[model samples]
Target: AVLGQRHEKNFRPIHYASKIITEAELNYTTTEKEMLAVVKVQLNELNELRDQAYENSLIYKEKTNRLHNSNIKDRVFNIGDRILLFNSRLKIFSGKLKSRWSGLFSISYVFPYGTVELSQPDEPSFKVNGHRLKHYFGGDRPKLVVPDLQTFPKDQ
Candidate 1:
């Protein structure tokens, strides 16, 4: 049986080809030859199913890639632009509330096909997938003001 994605909704079997194995086909094995003979048939039909599975898999892959790429915006970073790198391997034992991004890295170089070279202050530059990067707007800092003593409360 071969299954395929006819629509984006669900998977449905597109084709099914079956052949029952005979006694001669199961000549060697001492196991349940009766059941084996009734089941496997020839490798040819299985091979056809395998080929169909591969073709269907390719279609699924293409569709998945299309859907994924759709959500991705093309980002072009200039040299010295601040960016954050997403930690792709941080899934294990990590809380979802914690940030997976690990950079205040600057773009040292940009290349084709969503590849980037990033460098952090006092650290060596490294190449990473550009999909893992996003622009950084700098960290937040609060301003402090000193008031004159004349405006200060004397009760304390």
Candidate 2:
């Protein structure tokens, strides 16, 4: 009878230990599932934030473009007007004192959409974009005067 009582005590401890282990495993699985659900919710929120940031960037770019376009001044040109051509090639070389304008061209024709035909004294006329030309305010014609040497007294 004592042996049977000892066996019963051992069996009871083993059964209780297995029951405790099973409950611990169940709690661990439940916690893991809850953490996974939280991670999924956080991922969804991150995606939404990314989308909102992209939309805000697009809005900012559009507003900047509109402001820039509004600030641009319109230039008008007519036939027979004298203009100076902007020398874009000068930008390649470093020279702050050098002038970027290189022409006293006359506008032979003005076409739609900013195209212009420029004519020089002896050169053939060529078409150029109107944006490269600015009005020359110097004069209708340039003049040259030669000083007579006889007017000055000759030193002995």
Give residue 152's lDDT in candidate 2 (0 to 100).
67
Q: RMSD for each model, in Å, please? A: 13.6, 14.6
Query: Where does candidate 2 stray beyond 4 Å?
Result: 1-28, 140-156
Worst 10 residues of 2 by lDDT: 12-21
TM-score of 1: 0.44
Cα lDDT of model 2 by residue, 11-130, tens digit:
322111111234543566645644544555567679999999999999999999999999998999999988999999999999989989887999999999999999999999999999
lDDT of each residue in 28-114, candidate 1, tens digit only: 554554344334445557888999999999999999999999998768788888898888788776597887877588899989888
Instruction: List clashing residue pairs in candidate 2.
Output: none
Model 1's alpha-carbon lDDT is: 0.74
Worst 10 residues of 1 by lDDT: 33-42
